[model samples]
Target: MSTTNKLLAGAAILVAAYAGSSWYVGKKAEAEINHQVNEINAAIATQLALSLGEGEIKLNVVDYDRGWFSSKVNYEIRIKSAKDEQFQFLAQDHLRHGPFPFAAIAKGHIAPLLAYSDAKLLPTKETQPLFDAAKGEEPLRAHSFISFGGATKTVIDLAAIDYRDEDGNQVLMAKSEGQVDYVRKGGKEQADFTMTFPSLSLVVDEGDLHVQLNGMRANGSITEQDKAQASEGELHIDQLGINVENSTQIFIENIKTASSYEVKDGLLDSTLTYDFGKILADKQDLGQMQLDVGVKRLDYVMLNQLSQVDDLDSMDEDELLPMIKQILVNKPEVYINNFMLSNPAGSSTLTSDVRFATTALDPVENEELDLGHYVESLNADIRLSRQMIKGYFSGENMISSMADMFFNSAAEEAQEAGLVEYDGNEAKLALSFDAATNKLLLNNKPISVEELVQILFSMQMGGGLF
Candidate 1:
């Protein structure tokens, strides 16, 4: 054959192969739509239950149109909260089947995928306000590429909002975007995502109230381990400010939060930390603060069941007692690993760890609960800088003066009574309790439970200290 003819034949063969594979993928994609929707619903429900305690989400396919190369699917999403409040929304998805979807190719994403989908929220009576806020643009849009290996990478965009009410109330949001990579295999699902929001503002003319947040970003990931789920995330804001007419104006800078949850061996552990780099109120600098807290060895099953309860308030003591006992049987530990605040004046720090005891009392045998017996141990340390305390209450206001006086009197009395140890510049308090030994110590000095209770009661009754 001539060279030109040979090249033409080769090109034709390649085109034929691509067309055949694309058609097959389109058929496969159509067949899997319902199954995928079910999977998505299950995942959403699980996530909602974990995060919100009690909620359900479902996605139902309303229409599907299949073609040789692409398909259109419409879905209705329904959400029900723990309060039984329901929200419904509609979305439309356009899917282009692979191996070489034209859209993906045009975007320079040519590695061969099962399909690529573009989905957008459709405006409805309930969502019309959101659409109007976005100036008639779709409030939410997502583009997803589904790999042949059952994984997906999706990019989500949130439209910028500029909304104002006749009453002079206004809300504005900058355009935000996020990406998610998700995969499910071997009966387990994993996902990673990141999101960024440049700014948000809320204003009300009634009180001259205004709140703003800027440079907010968050990233998170969730993975299944041994049939259980573990997740972690961090959120950071460059600055947050609030102002009201004739009221204190508050501003916080470089605020961050990190949290994690995990389950292992039928027990759950979680931790949360918050850090504030700078805080200012009414032009007064409050310095910085950090807090870290966590819980460990909680009965995962019991907690999960408790989280699923939609009406805890309706449950009587008789019904709730057993569930509480089940959770206590695991002997969970709660701790405040660090609570610190600092300024140029000085700093204060506190740490505490407390654990619950596994009780042998049965709900049937013991109708009345004795919470003291359920405490395994307690240990805490507190260190306060005298300078810091003084500086905090140094303002020339009636409240500050009264607070300073109260603290001075209390500190002197407490030190004299040996409940608090005062160093040159710092005051320290250490408390420990052991249930097995039936012992309680304050500042390393043994104190009977009765005496401690009496001391606290006396302090509350306006006594200096005991």
Candidate 2:
């Protein structure tokens, strides 16, 4: 054959091979879709059981039309809430079989893959309102790149919304987008995702109310480990503003939250932190505040079973009390690692640690619950800066005046009762409890339980003054 003919022949052979592989990949993609549906259903069942029949969810592949190099799939999702309210959603997917799908190649994705899918939520009678809110656009759209190695990278987009009513009420939402990368192997799964929303606003002309939130972002990761799940996440908002009648305005800046959960030695540990960077009311600075709280040594097994209880309200008290006792006997610890507020004047701080006893209790023998028997030890400290308190309550506002008076009265009463110790620039309270010695101390001064209870009761009755 001539050189030109030989080149054409080689090209034809390559095309044929590509065509064959594309068909094979299309078939495999269809099978994988079915397998994933089964997995989803299994997960829904497990969740339902664990939530004690809180809700029901099921996903079904209603149709799959497989072509030589592409396929169209339809899916239906049914959800029944704990309140028995039912909702149905439909999704349509266009899958291009790959080894080198045309769409992927167009995007310069050359590596081999099983398929690329473009999916969109379809409108139904129940979802018409959602569609209308999106100005007739689909509420959600997602694109997925599926790899032969059972991993998927997906990009999801949520449509922006602009809605108004005859009553002069309006709501506007900016488009939100997210990406998820997920993989499951050998009975373990991992997923990471990040999402962003530019802004959301609601306005009520009649009430002169306007609420605006801007620059919201969230990122998270979940991983399965040894039949357990560990996860961590953070959420942040650049600013949140609320204005009422142009007179009362509250603004919060850089609101952030972080949380984590993990398992260690068959026990669960978790921590959560919140930071409100700057809070302002009517343009007056209200300082910044943060809280960090954590729990350790939680009996994962007992808690897991407790979570799976079919129905708590209907369960016999005889059976439920013991389960709770068993959980408390595991000696879990709770910590308020840091609770702080800072401003130009000064700072206030509070910290606490409480632990439960490991000793088991017989509910049958002890008809009435005594918290002292289960509380192993407790330690808490509070330091209030006098300057900070004065600065915070010095605003020329009715609310501030009331708060100032209340704080002054409470401080005087507490100091007189020897519950709070005052230093040069701060007021301090240190409380500790020991179950072994049945001792309670306030400001390093021993106090009887009865006396402490009476003081607390007095505070409660006398408008929260000690």
Candidate 3:
């Protein structure tokens, strides 16, 4: 062979060897990236535990394939409290690009998903269960929030979480940009959302949904498809505000607030209102509370997430009762400036203002009246302000006996004792709190607050004599 031919053959071999080496490196890099993702997720689980320190965390991590050259890593962190409540959080998605030696990393375009499930623990002995749960549901959340930088954003929501269909579709969908805390679980366009499961065609379904829209609030709104589930506890920002239909989705429209969490009476409350799009719904069930609930009448959930209530621990049972009493005033207010809920069943809209009042809740009385027990003092009045209350007699009884009053408060007494007379829908209801007997009387008869109390004081001083 001539020198030129030999040189060509040698060059070809060298080129082939370089190509083989590159293939090996690329394959190993892919494996390493995947392995790293798993490791990152493992670390996240420990890093997100409620008692945050060096290694107590929870996470929902998903491995995404951007392309042969690039990959997207998405996931969320979920911290939990003792109650069956979750604190949601968003973690940065780790996006890796290019060949190993010159790989690149980028952050997500829209904020990543971060939230926990509407669940709680069973008091297991395990130190952490979210790590296991996070891995299981990370994929579902990934499909829930994935946008590759588009002009017009898309929103998909999943309501009717508790109801299911025959075709195995249980998640009801309402779409929009970001998520509104309250979706129309009872709307007309009720559709099941399962992007991961493509076989099920869109179908109409039956479920309880409350969809509200004010002509002024939802007129210029555009809706996207809402189909996402976070099995693992992670928060997804893809769906913010009620982009769908029912968005009294009032969030922190223009207020700057920090993030925090509160646990009370065995319930966990998330207290952060992020950006202008944060879903800060007032939970009627888990109303405003703080770790130091005994000391102050401050709301620890929304406006006061960062507020450190004074004398949290030093408060005694005496101090704490009043504070807890204060929570009753902040019950959820559903004000329909202009409301509309349209669907197959029916729809109604009207302007209304509902105020949550803590008028009279004697915590001292409540604590003593636990279980099926209640102390009652019945003060029957005669003609309470033309309300025509017949008799001005009072009696005290146990809840067991009190329940009799609910059914037969005056049935037998009215017949046997001939206390009062006559009535048909004029039935009234009031529980006269008994400080001594801890009893409550069900007045299906006419009565006044002042007359009722007077009867009670008279009974304490011995019925007829006082």
Candidate 1 residue pairs that clash: none
**TM-score for all models, in order of appearance:** 0.88, 0.84, 0.26
Return model 3's CA RMSD, one decimal.
Answer: 18.5
Report the C-alpha lDDT of model 1 over 149-226, residue by residue, as the tens digit: 768899999999998888999999999999998887887778889999999999999549999999999999887756
Q: What residue runs in model 1 are displaced by over 4 Å at the alpha carbon? A: 1-19, 27-52, 183-188, 360-372, 393-402, 436-438, 462-466
* Candidate 1 global TM-score: 0.88
Winner on lDDT (1 vs 3)? 1
lDDT for model 2: 0.82
Best by TM-score: 1
At residue 220, candidate 1 shows an lDDT of: 90
lDDT (Cα atoms) of all candidates against the true structure: 0.83, 0.82, 0.31
- The order by descending TM-score is 1, 2, 3
Tens digits of per-residue lDDT, candidate 2, 1-466, equal 9999999999999999988999999999998788767755754564444334666688999999999889999999998776678999999999999988888778778889999999999989877777889987778999888899768898999999887878999888999999988798888877788999999999998559999999999998877667676778899999999999989999999999998887656677888999999989888788999999998877666666665564668879888877767767668899999999987778899999999875546433555544466678999999987667666765656765676566666777777667787655677899999887888898899987678777877767766554
lDDT of 3 at 284: 13
**Higher-lDDT candidate among 2 and 3?**
2
